[model samples]
Target: MKRPTLSKKIDQLIYRNHKSATTNVIGCLVLHAIRSEIFERFQRAYVGMANKESSELGNLPTSPMAERARTCETTGERLRNRELAYGFDLDYKNDPPTLVPCTWSKNYAIGLYGRIGLQCYNLQNGTNLKFKRLEKHSTKRTGRYSSVYITLDATDPATGSVCSFQTQFSNAGSHLRLRARITWLTFAARIKQIPNEPIDDDWDEDTPGINEFYKVPLPKWFSDERGSKKYYVPESELHDNDWLQLLMEVAFFSKANRRLDAYLPLELNSVVVETLEDEPRDKLKADNAIFYISYKCCADPCSTPLAGDHRAVVRKTMDGKPGHMCLEVAFTKEQNKNEEE
Candidate 1:
């Protein structure tokens, strides 16, 4: 056998003299991912990779590796136990998109979509499940369609008992159309060991609603979610960072779509807004929601501002999800100069 030198092109790798050359490959890769285009290609290759990350709590795969992991400790868990080691949740490349719960509770827009999914499922299955509240949700984004997986508890009228559910949907173009859809949905099973209407336990808490629903809802509109609620908000709320950005974007694209020419919104004018709520006509209730913003945006950044009222149809919700939601300019309505002034 040839002598194995510590490193290539070197006589020896003196372990003591040089602290072992740490490859630090992961760190390097992370840096490269941020700096290089190759990382984007890598991300594209694994765009839907989380579809295979099914080792979530209740949805754990029956694979041998997963089976063994269930009985004992996982390598990650072992690493976590060691004080010397540390873990970064969803910080690394290829990690499952982080799940959002602590935040979704306050996000009214997300709650709107969750209701739409439940409403659609009810329409198709001939079941009336009243929405209680959102528990959590996650999402995977792509250029054209961003996939959403949502979890929440609901009230089953037939049983008059509370039940929990998970649903998956996409925000493509199914805005306020009953032709809207959810990819899959599931509810908590009544296991004897689980007591009291089978509410959320550790197993239920960790269970994901990505690819499994008890039954398909709205086979026709099953690819997306659509529906929206409308109410007046204090003008101050419109200036919130996320809301302002979204409204501006909606303003920019709305003008561009009709004109087919490049245009941008320079300023947002505060005004009491009239909101529109559209209901889908076909299979299920609308889950893709649209928001009506009666606000003005400057067409020419350097010129005098013109007043305009626009409605934004925001379809998607962020991932974790509060990450990304779709928004659209429904229509640009003209405001009388007298009123605008």
Candidate 2:
């Protein structure tokens, strides 16, 4: 009969030395793995104990057979009594992987096209001018909105100096005519991870607003946990020490579209900030100050504009509300035709 494999032979030996002096290569490899933190608590309890080590320098007894017997006896006792070390609180194989919240920030600027200007609506004299406004929307349509207004750089080309004039009409108007033709420019946003509270329960995928926000699907291994409020996954789903793999997987599955280049889960605020100078500007900013406002989009690059949720019109609130700023931009036929093209 063929000789049994070294591992099988070692298992039969059970760490006990045979009468013939022979080395236990299989046993040594196992002991080395234990010492390297491969197992939860085995190394700390049985490592370096008398008669347990494979080498003679481990204070082994004079008799090899006796030393082997002692090693197996002590190890067996520990294993039978269920005293295996458990370093982790949850089961390594079963616990849900935790995702922490994080924050990211970027220095953003909003400006109109270079050498482009809008027809001065309220000015007594028609002067070419441009304007930019920071708009914030409300979760509830109480017909209220807010804006952060900044001074526009509007001056006559002949003077070669910026000028300022006060008028009652809103500078936030559509249609910024350009003196020169503009080319398409691409931009990308920077993402950083921060620490935030983890969700043990299921995250609500059925939430109304979230559906419009998140576009990517969850990972295949994710479990809904019987209609809970969060996504649950095994802690061991990703290989240990494969941190980059984990990050990429999360980013790939995140609903932020490819607009999200990176993700950091262990951050503090879970804040997402995109600057006007970043990649999403094309989808979020005005095209020559005359295009419709775009809403949340999917990751499919080939998807049609009709497939997107188009928030084509903007309206300013007329109600005398101190808390919100409501402004409106009507969708023109020209704009609609341009969107279709």
**What local distance difference test score does each model get?**
0.40, 0.28
TM-score of 1: 0.30
Q: Which segments of candidate 1 are over 4 A away from where they belong?
A: 1-104, 173-341
lDDT, candidate 1, at 59:
62
lDDT of 1 by residue, 256-303 (tens): 433323334544454222222243432112223333334556555455
Q: What are the RMSDs of all candidates, in order?
A: 20.0, 25.8
Best model per TM-score:
1
Model 1: residue 53 alpha-carbon error in angstroms? 28
lDDT of 2 by residue, 206-305 (tens): 5442222122211122233423222122334323312213222222222222233323232111111112222223321211112122233333446433
Candidate 1's clash total is: 24
Would you give me the overall lDDT of model 1?
0.40
